[model samples]
Target chain A: MKRSFYLKIFLFVVLLFSSALADAAEVYYLGGPQGSSQEAAVNPSYSLKQRFQDLFSSLSSIRKDPEASGSISGHLSQTVVHNDIGGNREKSYLKPGVNYITDLNFSIQEKLHADYNFTGQWFLRKTDDPRVESRRDVRLKQVDLQVANERNLYQFGDFYGSFSQFVLGSSLEGFNMDINPTDDQHYQIVIARRNEADTVANSFQRNVFGFKADRYLFKGSDLFSDFRIGVQAASSQDDSASLPDNHTAKDLRNTVFGLDGEIVFKQGLSIQYEYAGSAYVEDEDASEKTTTYANAFRFQPSMRLGKANVRYLYYYAQPKFYTDAGSSMSDKIQNQVSLDYRFSDRVNVTVSENYYWDHLKGSSRTKRTFNDEKYMTWNLLPLASRRSFNLRPYVNYQVRNSDDPGNSAESTTLTGGFDISDRLNAHTNWGVGYECRSFIDRVTRSNSEIFHRIRFNWAQDMMLWARRLYYAITPNVDIRHRKGNDNKDVTVGAGFNVQYDLFQRVFLRMGNTLADTNSASPSGDYVNNRGFWEVDFLVDKERSAHFIIRGERNNYTAENGAQSYKEQRVIAKFEVNF
Target chain B: MRTKTIIAVLLTSMIVVGCRAVTGAVVDRRAVAQESLFSLAGTLIKDLFDNYQDFSMESFRAKVAVDFVSSRNDLVNNAASNIRAAKVLDIDFSLDQVLSDKDLLMVDLKWQKRTRPYDSSNVVLTEGFTQAVFKNVAGQWLLYQINKDNPF
Candidate 1:
């Protein structure tokens, strides 16, 4: 009777959000630990893998009732890893021990309008280590209740915000607002302790208050239409004053302010810009005040000319230009131009150029410049429609100058490759292709390299399983002359990959790569290379059960210690959903 | 030096414009606020990848105050000021996921950027995810915000 009552209650909750697909409340913020067993301790923010686990758990809960709205899911997964980084075979006791991980997620969302939600996770895992320390842990990954309406969003417990690029997007306990009083503008406000989500309290979990406002200007004007301008300000106080980084709470505070905008012309031209400035509170005993600034800018123009579309772009970013939430676009400037033309029936061409400069922040180091060129595959594609075989050929070239940013060294490379495939019967096909590349580098002058590769692949589709196999062979030579030294090196390699399925429930995948290098020199020269082989067998049944056995080997050889290794690993995993 | 560089660029642009005029193929395109959400979202990405101006690179960002963000253009120029020309590498614009409701459209995008540094000849690959949100305004969709949720 108790079991039936619980089931009925679950059904009632699911019925509440049955119509969620049509006009669902947004999940603007879902914050928790985002890391793997290998990365969780060091990563302060929740991980992507964790999010997927949470989603699957929610899905399981939804399966109970078609109209179910609550979030509760059970999960079980295990992985074991063995590694040996030391080269000594006799030291059996020193071999790395196995590592294991398992977790469970329970999430709930209760919404009459689903304008609000209560969701969290209970995660447990264990790590094995013979030398250092093993960890057996259980923690609340997150427990947060969220409420949202047309103009407001509120969350308690654990949450994060995505307000602006310069603003901290850190996980914390906070109240946030996504308020829109007027149609043309909106505002976001966040007040939380950054790094508070760390399983262990961080020494610098500062309390930060941030707000941002955006105003859309000139709703429908040609030049001004769709233009968005935003301003933001944030200040953080040393919430953990007892820590060493902020003893007495004097030297550990900061203020950030920024402005960003984009103006677009209907004529396929645009200008985008961002600026961020951060001021750090200085200790009373410090000698100088420290402040940092960063910026990003881009210009793009695109057009259709005759029968082709042409685009040109230039990008620039300052080194150390830090935005707490922005992608790293620092220390480099780049330019890209491309022209893609499609001719009536027999002709198609794509041409593009890319150039970049790195090390702009170095005061004394010269900058390095790179140039890349792509001339699209001259595929006799029309023949494919009228004939049994099609040919596609392409060229790639690159020129790099200096390891240092300036005129210290240079390297140039070019390649030409092609692919042609024949359609054999209804279920089988095979293709073969080859390419050659030449490279030359002159740090102090005198280096030459040439390489060639051949690739072939076959595939067949029949019964309930599809099978495919691909292989490639590559050979290369390199010669270097410096002052009184001369060295010659040659390398040969091959690779194979295969995939097959049996009974529609079992899958097999495998790949192998082998390479060898030979070097001769009067002064001193060494060659190094790596060979790898991996295979996996998976059994998946009706998406309910999954099992996989995987093994991998990495063998490395080198005359010099620059690179050398030999390692092997095997893994078995099983997963099921109820 | 900066002034000279700017002047040189302007001169080069004029020459290019003159050539386009001679061809009589220079067409005008405009994206006002009348576009739908999908069109508007696509334009935001297009503007971001195509614009070459330092300031134009910021065109896709919301036009509101974003405290302490270094202007993307300035950052680029600072990184490679001597570089007067550039070209984008293999970048694929894929809208991997989309969610929409009455007044909002949220999109998960995968942007693959392959490029050589302004002064180097080696390519660097920075692939990441960005979440973009669009809001409906007066029967038109406009980009409201962008967050870089890149996988580190």
Candidate 2:
């Protein structure tokens, strides 16, 4: 009864808020239109007939809903540079060996009712390499489909579970992820050195797929709920070729299964229990088949008083691994207790302490994994009374263990940040922290460090014929001090950006950034100083056509007392969205 | 230095015209006003029950310094005798929400009662009006739309 009461209150408040929003403003303000040169009135109720006509005239509306609709776009870039170092002049050309990048997406959403809806999207991309690629080439990007349903499946305590929409389920909607392009190459291989006639046709294919889905059952209740769940499983596989004798391939497969249930008591409190397990297989060693699994459970109790909301969550997960040696397990526990409190109208404070513990097996090892379990308390305070001026202060503290060693290692740090005037801004953050650790045979070392960063920035808008240009200057200083080592670095950077509309459908932009670091290592050169410049020209005509041309130059100082090296590149692309 | 100055001047001119700075303020003010009204209206409706007794449209009209004349549902002998009469004396109204440019006003009306409703126990009949209008002197919203049984 108490749980339901809370649910009613929650729904009532949401309803009130929505109505308030609607009656307060006839239409929502979401900024300017696409490629708009000026901000204009986007009133939805300006004219009901006109609004409907605009909607009907949209490209998406004309295409009609289908099982899927997507497109693929790719571009190519080339760079040629001449290097004159040590009196030796040489020219090197860099371009894509096989540049092909494409993205194909499709979605199908069948309307069930006015109140109940189901949607899904299928997303895929092909690329050659993600880390580094020529303007024209890409790598095995991604491919995945997702589906979701609302009020269409089973409902548990305030949760829903659907089995038919897991990851790659029939519902493919709302799939958004970054992807690189893909390039494919076909070749013929000789099965036998002497049997040229016995050649076999070969093709290289690389693809990555990621998806997320949940089957919610017995959901939307305040108390006592159960769910059957599955997901696309976060997994990836890659195969790439370099020079001869340099081939790398990887295959990772994962299948996830889970069940969850929740119980809401009469006191407006609830506890949720979830037991999920996954089987992950990777192509690493044939002799050793690796398997990893995890189970987690969380409990949350919440209360709302007027405009203030208070809630707490307690979560625990035990991850287990199986290897050829035997079965081993570890307990990873994260305990976070925080209160999100609002003070007045302009101040928000989030104070919380997080304790993470990763204990392997039953042994109490002094040194944990790469990131050891520690007790940390973080404080964030933000004050934004207006859009022009903002201030945020943060502090962090980590508890020290006896096994840790460092010189002058303190476990506390305090930092402050501030931003002023939309045009001019300044920020500074400083922290003092220490680390203590024990080495072999009970020998301990403690280290103390102080870090500080200060920067000031200024920017202003410039008017160009039917365009806007912006310029900014920033000066930065970084200071670090250890028990015995001290370092101080100062950098002055300037950047300029200009965007102009040459025609109704054409726009041009030029930007440049130059930063010069003036700190010399005990021995010598400031190798970190860099300069970059880029310009882009774009022509856009609604859904009809878009053309883009961009060129960039990067320059860096050499560390070996040699002349600086620079690389320049240019690219052009065209796209049509309908 | 001279070239930089010229470029700056040219850039500034271009931005001011391209962004339509002249019209930006007009659009922004309207949006801000609309948003403020929305938030305020939401708060008032959520707490309307608390002010039901004192919220009256007739009194609100009077408080706005507007004279009102009402025709009762029951009459006797075509005279003022046995006829329910309502006259707004003093009202204090605040526009809690206003949408459609300055056209529609979501008002929170507070006024005194001259003739009480027969069913005084029913809050809906006593203080049912939460929204009003100033579209015109006569065609203005005088009755609460919540009472759909009568459209007057």
What lDDT tens digits, residue by residue, belong to model 2 across residues A76-182?
22323222222101211223233333433333333222222223323234444221232334332212222112111211110011121111111111222211000
Interface RMSD of each: 23.9, 34.6
Correct interface contacts retained, every candidate? 0.01, 0.03
- Give the lDDT of residue A562 in candidate 1: 34
For residues B1-152, could you state the per-residue lDDT of candidate 1 as single tens digits?
65447534533432232222111111111111111333456675655454321121112222311211222223332322211221122244544334343455555566655432322223344567676655566665555445565211
Flag regions of model 2 displaced more than 4 Å.
Answer: A1-257, A261-273, A277-308, A319-330, A363-388, A400-416, A419-448, A459-462, A470-475, A527-540, A562-564, B1-152
True-structure Cα RMSD, model 2: 29.3
Candidate 1, A301: how far from true, in Å? 4.2
lDDT of 2 by residue, B46-142 (tens): 3432122122221221223111111111010111110112111112232212322122333333221212111121101121223332222354432
